[model samples]
Target: MEKTTNLQETVHSPKDEGGTTLGLSLDKAWAPKTEEKAETEAGNDSTGDAPEENHDYVTGYKLALLLASVTTFFFLQMLDMSIISTAIPQITSDFHSLPDIGWYSGAYQLTSATLQPLTGRFYTRVRAKWVFLFFFFIFEVGSLICAVSKSSVMFIIGRAVAGLGGSGLQNGGLTVIAGAVPLESRPFYMAFMMAFGQLGLIVGPLIGGVFTQYVTWRWCFYINLPLGGVAGLFLALLHAPDQIKKPQVSFSLLRKVIPQLDLLGFAIFAPCAVMFLLALQFGSSDYPWNSSTVIGLFVGAGVAFPIFLYWEHRQGAEAMIPLSMVRQRYVWVSSIQFASLTTSVFVGGQFFPIYFQSVKGVGPTLSGVYMLPGILSGLLFVLISGSLATKVGYLLPWALFAGAGTAVSAGLISTWGPDTSTAKWVGYQILYGVRGCGLQAGVITLQNVLPPAQGALGIAFLIFCQNISTAVFSVVGNTIFTQSLVKQITALAPSVSPAAALAAGGSAEAVRALAPPGSPELAGVIQAFANSFDTVCYLLIAAASLSFVASWGFGWIDVRKKPEPGKGDV
Candidate 1:
């Protein structure tokens, strides 16, 4: 065990030169040193620690302010993603394009997911601040387009554009925090950022429901204009630590990296994602399991995935994903946990409103109101868990608790009958709120474990997993809903076919038209939905259990130890 004193001297001397000094100091001098441990565990390989020069400097308060702004931007971006779900029914009716309604959500998700890796590269090459501002403008433009959109195509286009900007904003929020904040202070700032994002999630549905019921769905898009303007303005005005040095764009670098980008990998990856999402959304309704489209999609994803893996390994250093990172026990396990947690959230998001509208007979606005408890719970937990993590320096127990709580809450909520009491329902929502707190805390823990230089890349990879998992699980949950509904409806009404029942657009109006007044068929529909919800909850529970395993895999890393005098933070 050894203690270092390099930081004290560097802190006192302020220099305008290109080099910036960072030092780490440990309070407990007897703890086993990082260098000694690394030597014993692996070898004497240098960890690429180099002194940073001409570093961009910003005040801590200013950095915090900038973090807040970016977090708000992220909140708005995600709000637009989920807020529209409740309003889709109304939007489709007004536009008279029910058939193409899925596009509204799909377009945003597909484009955003596809561009995520590219954005990670872009951040490395370009000034993040200007890049963020550009995206902000694009987001505003997309919102304006949606606000005035006269047709479904126009709205889809607008959503696509918004998705592009949102992809950047979401990634930028994490990247900026990683770049600007010291490792120790990051948890606190991350908590604040995540809280803002949860606030947006809570508000988005409620706002969307209100606008859809009272005003128009267009307002959902219109509202972003003013909010985004304010956020972007603040960010543009603020100064933060700049990590990107001047663009060192080199043809040689590109030549070395271009093959690693793996265009073939994307060709396979993109279609697999799109097809799989389509299978979930349209399966059993528009296409059967044996149908050519569904079969083709599943088979394509199956075949392409292995090829992508082989290419990734072969490309090695130049690969889009560093295989070493993927191979790390901590990294892969954390990523799996992250993916599972995201799946749980996505599944819940999809079905909770259905329960409110279809079973509880609540309007869209009230459904959003029902979601409030979960959102608030998540907000509170994110704050507390973050602070706790900072103080205690351990994240496993909290993550396990969150996973278990989420599973239990989902299971309980799945038991709701058509006549379930509102008080009981609210209790389940509270459990969901607790779940939110744990999820964000676990994410921060994963980020904290990585070296600071890889922080942004780690966050980006986690987000990539989240996006892919959400898309895939959302599709699976939808499939469960459709399959259960068809089976239940067919059993209750032998004369009516599944296709005929679904043809009415899965709306309450169509269900009423198909079932006679006070018939057993209506009860069957309710039962079918109950079964579907239960199945999804069970899946979430399984994921939560996996999260527990992943949480336990976290290894110890000391953040307080300072590097040698010449060794840089990076």
Candidate 2:
């Protein structure tokens, strides 16, 4: 076992306050040292986190600040994802383009999802800190665009831009932790970051509701600017080492970097994914399922899907999502489990507002309150699950619990009506949130299975599945909700035109004004909306159920067992 002597080169920058180096030439930073391997096999370090090894990872006061900055940035990014939900009705009112509601979230998710793989490559080949800062800048710009947009098209474009930046925030968060901490302690830190994100995810709508009511919808986006500024300031002050390092920043490195991003694979994939989702989005609503536009999209996606797979297969090591990594049982299983569980969260977040606003006749602000229990509980469990997994050294129990619990809760949510008690909805959401807590633990398990070099890519692949499926199924949920609303309303309340109600700025106020609350007409509409929500609930139920099925594939690996030095960090 040979050792690394001078593979690392440190350079002091002007920003170094107390001798913290801004650049580390970490070509083989983690390359196994003969002495370190021996110490590891001998179990000398009682606590896995504080090994008697020096990799020059960010430490001391700097470590605390770095972790806080990343976690706060993540919280802001997540807040962006759901905060827009409460503002959607107001946005459509301002833009007078009610039909464009889907495009707002859709565009963001699309850009974030499609560009995710490339972000992975970027992190792996370049400095994680630089990649993160660049993406953060993009996200802030996108948020600014959203805040000032005067038209629907501009707003959608802004969302797309924000998503482009959002693609890297989570991946970057995980990458930074990987660089800074040992594998044994990563789950707790990662979970700590995720717990804050969960808080953001759970509370986003409520915050959006406050902005839409007291301030304005634009403020929801404008709020990101300040939070981003704070995070950026901290990150700028502390330029820590990256996980996969290049010798130095140069134009020569840029030449090699472009090809590594797999531009050709992305070209083939982006359009195909858009086409497939558009088909799902437009089918039976914008156009007949048999219409040429819809059919062409489906056919195009079907053909291109296989072509992209083949291209990726041939690309092998250079592929956007390395097939070698994808072939691993744990990697694929973790991806599926994470995607399904997360998709359910996204779908439920969107649908709950509809139920609260339209069926129960609550305002947007109140709806967010109704949602707080679930989000808070989910946040609590995220922290608990991460901490407990570290202590117990096992994660499979949580995985199984996530699948079974969320499924049951979703099914219960589907049965709710306008008259359903507050206790029931609160109870159901708590169930869903606690059950879903175990999902984040899967990422830790995934990193344990892959090779050392592929860590960022593995994280990116998981994010891609999550973003793509959430984007796809959000549209699907929209379609299902809309079709059901139209069909059910037309039958139950013949006097009312569902189109007119939706187009009346798509707000609860609009629908409620069509008839008095106690009238049979209003009752019929609420019932119809309630039923439509059930279909959307079914989508989540199915997604959560799939998590259970994927849980079985995780095998029986003990997460406490550290990966070999040349392999992964457990």
Candidate 3:
């Protein structure tokens, strides 16, 4: 409950401006005072206790400007994650490296998921406003690197760097809100922030397509420069109280802080995650399932995961994923549900463009346009879920709805063939959007149910799970799509080499160029691509089903009312 910063020593007295001070400490700041002091403070008009409670409740012009920055960064970060999907084809063609497509997407999420929890720790143990700005700058730098990269390896490196920075923006947005706004109004603010992000998520592919088809795929990364600059400016102008204690820069302090970061846990986890995903991506394509390379990766991941868990358990409070937090029902369930549902979203987003371009014979720009049905519907449902959660005080219905609805929609999507009508595709997307809407409601529910002290940790853990799932599932989808396309095409077109079809880049244009337009092999190529897409959709269904089972564990906690003082908010 100690003050995060020495406000009395570092800042001017609050008496000069309406007699208030920043309520900027963690859970301790909200702790109840002794009975005598509480009674005395209540009676003393000069102590300014009432005004202190309202000090950090940002409002009017300042609130608007702050939200503008948060929304911009949210959009940019989400956009960065998805924009690469449409650009991948052109990127692969340019580099002449089709086999490395999984790295292009998975690399970003790899660093993002692994670094997210550590960033949460940084926000808690440092001057968070500065940390937020630092992360944004890093993101901007990464975009610039991506825009100018000359090779696939360079671009993949840029993506990993960008993810390291992006890990902070979305999570930092929530942290800023928790610090500046009271608990009662958080859901509305969270909804507004997420709506902006959803807009980015939906528009990302379209932007990437336009850039790739009309100009160059590099523009997708170039667009981030000016937008990020504007967001950075707004954030710089805002003066906010520190949310946590700032560590003084010194070798001694650095030594202490390093251990608190649980570097050992991260060391174990990074390898574990990489090996697990590498094994899945390599199996059946680059290597046989039982090949030494694939088996070695699996064995490494299996060993690393347990070691990571053991290290984290031993680290106690400093653990990347603290054992205490994971044990809580609301925390673990929310993490699992968010991870599973979002994996479906990531898998669909990754492959939907291929479906449109390869099966439907659409150009990149038009393929992005075709994806609008799913993205727009998903955005609409996100806002609706937030509104419903705010009004109903319960999130269980939305979770249940998301799980079952996504499963059904995924099954429907899997049934789509080369001859399927546009209406059916559009309808299937709308059905899947139901799951998208429920995502943020689960976040709101998590924030509401956990104590304020635990909020940062919970949010970080959820982000980590979501990102890691996205990374793993993107690779899983990519491997499945590539392997299926090769197998199916080889079956129907014995004259077409599997390598040639794959190298043509998973689209109709590539297939058409490889086979004569009237040849039976052209039809088979398209069918193979469609079948590959269907595999991703089937995986989506399984992920959604697992999410449904996880949602049931959320129980019936209502978050509408504020918790009483001294209770741990749950």
- Give the number of the best model, judged by lDDT: 2
Per-residue alpha-carbon lDDT of candidate 1 for residues 1-570, written as tens digits (9 for 90 to 100): 343222112212222255542111222211234323322212112343321322455556787678778887888886876687667656755665444544566566656666665565445434567667777788788888888998878998897787677667766787677567655666777778877787877888799889877888788888888888898899988865534332333566456444435466566666666666666555634677788887887777677777767876665533445465566555676777777876787667766766666555566677789888877887898888877767776565677777777878877877787778888888887887666555654456445444333344456666777666665555566566656657766776665667654444323444455666677876666555556556667777776667666765544332322245555654
Q: Lowest summed-lDDT stretch of 10 residues in model 1?
A: 21-30
Q: What C-alpha lDDT does candidate 3 achieve relative to the native structure?
A: 0.75
Residue 355 in model 2: lDDT: 83
| C-alpha RMSD by candidate, in order | 8.3, 9.7, 9.0
lDDT for model 2 comes to: 0.78
Q: Against the unseen true structure, what C-alpha lDDT does each candidate score?
A: 0.63, 0.78, 0.75
Question: At residue 261, what lDDT does model 2 achieve?
Answer: 71
Best by TM-score: 2
Better of 1 and 3 by lDDT: 3
On TM-score, who's better, 1 or 3?
3
How do all models score by TM-score?
A: 0.80, 0.87, 0.86
